[model samples]
Target: MHYKEAKHILSASNGMNLYRGCTHGCIYCDSRSTCYQFDHPFEDVEVKVNAPELLEDALCRKRNRCMIGTGSMCDPYLPIEKTELLTRRCLKMINRYDFGVSLLTKSDLVLRDLDLLQSINARSKAVVCTTLTTLGEELSRIVEPNVATTRRRAEMLKTVHEAGVHTGVWLCPILPFLNDTEENLRGLLDYCFDAGVEMIMNFGMGVTLRDGDRQYFYRKLDEHFPGMKERYIRAFGDSYQCASPNSAELMKIFQAECRAHGVRYEPDDCFAWLSEYEDKQVAAQISLF
Candidate 1:
């Protein structure tokens, strides 16, 4: 890991990435695509050393409180964060300013900040989003070798929800001919329902391949699923959206299950939940008898 002094911490949309690269080793990470233009190696994490100060300054200037988001471009809880506390410092700033937070990650290391998360929720809002690719742990290990497995993430979700912090699951990028199966979808949804997740975000039952990410994914496929990369080349050619042949049937089942469980399935709805900020004072006033 290396440190870089960032000029600004938050994006126009109030999202920030404290780090620029990841070490999770997830084969399908779109952040590695050539379009993102990382000057450093994907594993050479670039830490924004001044992220907390920048974020506090940004929040102070905001006229209205809205969720400050992170983990869209890079995972905040990378192993380096165990000592750096960059992400934790930003969370403390958000909490101190009474702003809400919603973060996405594949690491169970989030449990370490339950104190901050619970405090934020008790004031405004704090939603944790975890990605659930497949239920089978062995397959998950093959694809996301360095990150927490699916089962462990589910356990983390359960603990977060029990602590009164709303949680969501990103059941996404279901690699075709790999995890794109009805059984896989059902098992993942079962974990969400069991965890009482407020929402389940799924783009489709297939993956998108770009110049940088496609080559890396195909390479991993060649290494593990032999002959599968050739199948993808033959089937998808150069299309960006490689929808699974089973997308329609799987989506039908997904919709039905989400409705039955009352879990939000629409992307916009889940995103709205994450973005909406609450005024604790107004909420407290409304609850008074």
Candidate 2:
């Protein structure tokens, strides 16, 4: 890990990635795509040393408080976060200023900051989002190695919901032949239902393969699945969007399940919910005054 001073922190949409590149080594990680230029290796994390200060400044100067998002390009609760405390510090700033947060991660390490997250939710909105790719622990280890297993992430969602914070799940990058089965989807959806996830975002039962990420994913496939790389090449050539043969069928089941369980499955609706901010405490205080 290396620290560098960043000129700017938050994006126009109020999202910030405190670290560039990820150590959590998801085999199908899209962040490794060539379109996102990285001067260093994908595993070599780049830390924004001035993220907290910049966030504080940006939040203070904002004309109105809105949701602050993070953990899109990289997981905020990566192992380094425990020591560096960059994510924790940013959450502190968000809590101090009473700004809403929509943080995404696949690590149970987020539980460490439950108090701060609950405080933010008490004052304003705070949504916890995570990705669930496969239900099998062995497959999860091979696909999303170095991160928490799917079961653990589901447990984290339950913990978050119990704390009275909203939770969402990203059911995506479903590796075609590997985890696109109905049984896998059912198992994962069951976890979501039990965890009481408010919403789920899925872009079909498929994965995206671009220049950089494609090559890396193929290499890993060769290493683990053996001959799976050739299968993908034969089926997809160099196509960017590689949809599964069973995408239509799987999506039908996914939508029906989410609807049955009252989980929001529409991407637009989920995103709108994340972007919307509500300050219940402030409203109540004003009402009292």
Clash pairs, candidate 2, are: none
Q: Write the per-residue lDDT of candidate 1 for residues 1-289, one digit (tens) a residue.
A: 8999999988999899999999999999899899998999999999999999999999999999989999888998899999999989999999999999998999999999999999999999999999999778999999999998899999999999999998999998898899899999999999999999999998888998899999999899999999999999999999999999999999999999999999999999988888999878678998994
- Clash count list over all predictions: 0, 0
- The whole-model lDDT of each prediction reads 0.92, 0.94
Q: What TM-score does each of the candidates earn? A: 0.98, 0.98
In model 2, the runs with Cα more than 4 Å from the true position are 285-289
Q: Which 10-residue window in model 2 sums to the lowest lDDT?
A: 196-205
The superposed Cα distance between candidate 1 and the true structure at residue 263, in angstroms, equals 0.5
